[model samples]
Target: MKKKITVKLDIQKIVRITGNHGGYETGECLLCEASGWLEGEFGSPYSTKDTGADLVHKKNCLMNKVLA
Candidate 1:
């Protein structure tokens, strides 16, 4: 019999921002201020839908790494 090993990724600490902030003008990580392609497309500190910003932060934000 062969045993299958599974690895668990900790995602409990990941925070998703989904609000409109008057001060938010760039699509950057609110915690680390890291900017990505989403920022270029949607402008920095975006106030609209945050799905793109969330994706970018999850992929490249230093804050996400630290939290994880």
Candidate 2:
């Protein structure tokens, strides 16, 4: 069996991330930012994560019912 991996978050990281892409117009999650989502970006594009299977991963997510 394989263990599940998760995205990590921190205060400084969040501040830096949000500061970089806080107003993308999308309600995607910031804390659980996924890497390589953007084309040639390699890093998460504006911290708008599409991986919302977990609770934290769903933070600020557009599909996240909690946000909706």
Candidate 3:
């Protein structure tokens, strides 16, 4: 019989890496007005990307702003 190898992963590390840390901070979500959110120009903000249908701006706006 062969033994199986199972590796356990940390959820906190995964969340931090995946950038899925949900919380109320500053500059986080432009829509929800969250903080610690990434900012960038994802999609065409001047085009149909801001039709309230496509929320590609949020994804594009991933700015890393740290507090002093």
Best by lDDT: 1
lDDT for model 3, on a 0 to 1 scale? 0.30
Candidate number that wins on lDDT, 2 or 3: 2
Residue-by-residue lDDT tens digits, candidate 3, 1-68:
99998655432332221244364212223432323332232222222334443222333332111110
Off by over 4 Å in 3: 17-68
* Model 2 steric clash pairs: none
| Order of the predicted models by TM-score, top scorer first | 3, 1, 2
lDDT of each: 0.42, 0.33, 0.30
Error of 3 at 3 (Å): 2.7
Off by over 4 Å in 2: 17-68
Worst 10 residues of 3 by lDDT: 59-68
Lowest lDDT 10-residue stretch of candidate 1: 39-48
Per-residue lDDT of model 2, residues 1-68, tens digit only = 99998654433333222222443322223445532222221233334444532123334432233222
Model 3 lDDT, residue 2, Cα? 100
Position 23, candidate 3: lDDT: 46
lDDT of 2: 0.33
